[model samples]
Target: MNDFPWLSVLIALPLVGAVAVALLPRDRETLAKQAAFGISAVVGVLAIVMATGFDSDGARFQFTETHWWIKQFGVHWALGVDGIALTLILLSVVLVPLVILASWSDAERSGGVDGAPPKGSVKTYFALILALEAAMIGVFAATDVFLFYVFFEAMLIPVYFIIGFYGGPQRSYAAVKFLLYSLFGGLLMLVSVIWLFPLSAKPVGEGGLGHGTFLFTELNTMHVDPTTAKWLFLGFFVAFAIKAPMVPVHTWLPDAAQQSPAGALVLIVGVLDKVGTYGMLRFCLELFPGAAKWATPVVLALAVVSVIYGAVLAIGQVDLKRLVAYTSVSHFGFIVLGVFAMTTAGQSGAALYMINHGFATGALFLLVGFMIVRRRSARISDFGGVQKKAPVLAGLFLIAGLAGLSMPGLSPFVSEFMVLAGTFTRHRVPAIIATFGVVLAAIYILWMYQRTMGGPVREGNESILDLTAREKWAVGPIIAVIIAMGVYPQPVLNIINPSVHHTLARLDRPDPAAKIHVAEKVAENGARP
Candidate 1:
């Protein structure tokens, strides 16, 4: 059973679904949506079944399938997943169906959304969604560097159209900016990936494998000089940072999120952005440990900046979508910070953060999307006292908002706590400063909630309806998962810890033990007196 090509099946199912969904007549918008949702749900279920078969302690990468796709370049149609990759794939599949459900009517009418007349039909909108889901799963599952890159770049297409044709007025500009930034990053990564080939092809006598290959496991054994490794690391890191949408490079995200449909934005920020941080953990740290360690200081500094800057900016946004977008920028900073902190707790926290952020932010975006559908506005001032009219909607928004802020007994809080705790164990000062981002998170999430869901029921908001049965179904699972994970995270951690330890072993680093004992001693000196 384990030998079955589960990952390929996972990828192919969604692609076939996309084609099937697309072939539906344009007039059959409802059928198109139902077909898309059903397909995504099946994919999600299949992924869950695959996860059940995974033995996290048995091997670093499982469900292995390796066949040469390009013999000349030694690239393989390899696919596998470690704990990190498996969890992320799960996050992607789980969200796709819900996104489809949440967006059922979002594209039904071209004129209803804020964009210029829609250029794509409703069937196309849902088809693009399924296509994006396929690419996302493939990227997470690919263990070959070249195959990973292929899936990485392919993900941009459906997303670009989803934004460009079915989103807000500025979607064209947003999609263009997104494409340009991504292509620039991807080109650099391609250079680095190409560079790895010759590095791997060098003679074994010269610390090389004596043959060209892009299989991740083989390349992990290849040796490159520090200078070359640093350059290669930088190439890959920049691409991921842009995707992670870290500070400076992250300018593309807010614009993209602002222009994206609520459903697409959920996938963009929730799953797509994660590819960046996951790349850092998998490729940068494991493949270029020295460069990763050397680059830690600068990366940590930038992560801290992203944390504070994103939160501060989110607090000030009048546009509801942009505000949530900025909060993601801030949330991602924590993920990056934890990754570079380079400790077991830190990296594990980083991995878990990716999943938690997906559900937390996804729910927020969907609920907000629901609000926008009724009011046809994304401005904070455009809403008030929504709780008076739609109590259930307002209540769910409050829970999701609190989760975003990392309030206690929520999954986001658990992940955030682990990140801060992990970082503190290794890098204290940056961890301290990054805590301010937490305070700012509270301010932004609460302030936005207060403005949109609080106060007297504004004249127009009085008639705003509660969540429909379908919307409740779409969001219910996420909320349950959040609470369940928040209360007990050990099950997921069991699946994540083995991969993290193996990655750390690859770096030849372990938790600094003697020094921690010494630090405790220093704190105890003369303290009893």
Candidate 2:
């Protein structure tokens, strides 16, 4: 298993599938959809196989593979997964097939983008999904900084077309906005990555040349100066925060979500957004612990602001898709909060939050997409009393909505609780303020559900249909997983906790000892006598 190229195979399968799907007869949309779904499913299966082979108690990075790629610059074709990356990789692969199934007929339904005919073919849309999957997997699996950057940048092209060519009337605007924000972030990261090569080769006394390696393992050992490391950290952090779509830099998300189809959103907001938070865990902190600590106060402040800001903004949204987007901005806030809390539980919870958010938000996007298809409108006022006619659709939407609010008995609740609990132990003020996000979440989620799914059957909603069999197949598994994981999250926790410890180890940080009030009082007085 160690010798096999698990990551390489996982990445290649999707690329090959995309090419094959594209090469098929252009007019056969149904065949293209089926082929895309089948290929994505196979990749998902392989990802599961890879997961089963992972040993939680074993090496920090399992199934390792390293080969020199750019010897001149000390880069390598390195690939591996720790618990953190594995969960995210699994989340990405698992969602792609479901997105395919949910999107089976969506491409055909697309209308002109702002009166301009769609530029891409139906098969091309399917092909892009496969291509995007390959890039996504590569980004998470790449241990080499250069390779990661390559995949990171490559992901934008497919999404650009998906939104600009296949989305709503304002899709052109939204796609361009998404692209520009992403490009700016990527440019900063590129500069940071470029600087690393030379730093790695400089003499040891000058904080360099630990065998001139760019492998993350080797790079972690270098002793860079405070000023240089801080600049590098900021470069990477800004790129990730934009990707994390944190406040100030997070404006691209709602616009993009408002225009994109639901299936594309499943991966877009659900998994793709996670790369930002993941990079914070993987690159920013481990590589520059001093800067990370320096930036913690500001980072936590912004995270809380994002939580409250997103939820409050969500309350005012009339568009269903855009509402869900704000909620995710809020959710990602929680994930980031747990991460920088510097507690084992906090980091683990953040990682777990990434997976749970994917399931919950993916389902919400798909279900909302279904309703829009029925009525050809994404407005909250356009829907009412849908449950009377389409109980199952309404039911699943409600479940997904509840999960978004971190309702108990759903998977998100466990992760959200862990994030808060872990953060409270380390940073009480931020954790307390962030708790209000839960209350605000209930307002946004339930309010959106009521407006869209709960009223007496509105005039146009009378003919609304329940989910088709294929739609159920697409969304049912996600709901079931949500409920099951919420009930018992230990299995996933086992995989995530070790990686959290490793990250904390990089910072030389440890879980704070429990503070007992009784012991403190007894010590103050001479004991009760």
Candidate 3:
């Protein structure tokens, strides 16, 4: 199993399925959908197999395979996984099949409210989805910086079409905005990637490249001057922040989410957006520790602002899809905060939060989508006493909502607690401010529920049906996992701790408590007779 090239198989399987789907007659929509779902399911099972075989005690990249891809520039087609990458990869694979299942029927629906049949072939829709899955796996698993960048940029293409071709009236605008923002960031990162190559080319004997490679292992050992590292760090950070969709840059998300299909929105917000926070951990902090430390104050501030700003905006949203999108901005803020806290506990919490947020948010989007389909409207005002008509659906919505607000005994609560606790130990003021975001979370969630599900059955809502077998299957595993992770996070924490320590070691930044302890020891020694 060690030499089986599981990573390559994982990356390629979906693409193969995509090809198979594309080759089928364009009119064979059902077959195309089935093939796509089957492929994603197989990939999901393989991911589980890979996880079970992974070394939880190991800190270094595992299941690694490297082959020179661009020897001219010393880049390799390197692939591997550490605890962090593995967690995100698991999130990506697990969600893909569920998204496919959720979309099975929706893909056949007409484009928008009161619109004609979909303009594109269902085969193409599912094909693009499968292709997106492969790119996501590559993004998380790639060990080569150049290879990572390639996957990173390639990811945008399918998502662009998914939104533009399958989305709402404003999809074209949303798709264009998303692409421009992503491309701009990718360009900045490309500059940084190019700059690092020459710096990494020099031999290690002369304090330069160890193997003249883009492999993270080789690059981790190469040191850059402080000024240059900071510049490069900005190039990478800006790209990630945009992807993270933090505040000012977050405008695109609500538009994109509103225009996109619910299933595709699941991947957009759940796995795709994670690339930003993931990159911050993988590239910004790992490769430029000095710059990370230097930029900490500003990053933390933006994170805090995003937390508060996104929640407040969510409270004001009339569109259900757009509301969920804004809430993600808030959730992602916590993720970034945890990552930049520079503590082992904080980083581990951040990693777990990424996974938990995916489940929680995905449920919210899908459930809300269920409501929209029934009402044929996205307006929150269009719903009222929905619970009275569809008690089961309302119950599921409550579970997802409770998880979203980080209520106790749900997956998100555990991770959110860890993030806050860890951040408090390092930066009390920021932690305190972030807690207020949680308060706003409860306000928005409960308020939205009251407006949409509570009260007497509204006239239009009385005829609505409860969740179908398919919808139940779609949400059952998510709810079960949410409760299970909340009760027992140790399974995930065990996998996360080793890599968290490794990352902190690379940063060379001691825990705040450790620094305080050292200071006390030095002062006592100075006072000794």
Model 3, global lDDT: 0.88
Residue range 243-360, candidate 3, lDDT tens digits? 9989878998999999888999999999999999999988999899999999999999999999999999999999999999999999999999999988766787798899999999
Candidate 3 TM-score over all chains jointly: 0.95
- Residue 28 alpha-carbon offset, candidate 3, angstroms: 1.0
lDDT tens digits, residues 138-222, model 1?
A: 9999989999999999999999999888878888899999999999999999999999998888566755466688999998988
Which segments of candidate 1 are over 4 A away from where they belong? 110-115, 202-209, 514-529
Worst 10 residues of 2 by lDDT: 520-529
- How far does residue 303 in candidate 1 sit from its true spot (Å)? 0.2
lDDT of the candidates, in the order given: 0.89, 0.88, 0.88
Over 447-493, each residue of candidate 2 has an lDDT whose tens digit, in order, gives 88888778688988888889999999999999998888877777888
Which pairs of residues have clashing backbones in candidate 2?
385-455
Estimated TM-score for each candidate = 0.95, 0.95, 0.95
Model 3 — which ten-residue stretch has the worst lDDT?
Answer: 520-529
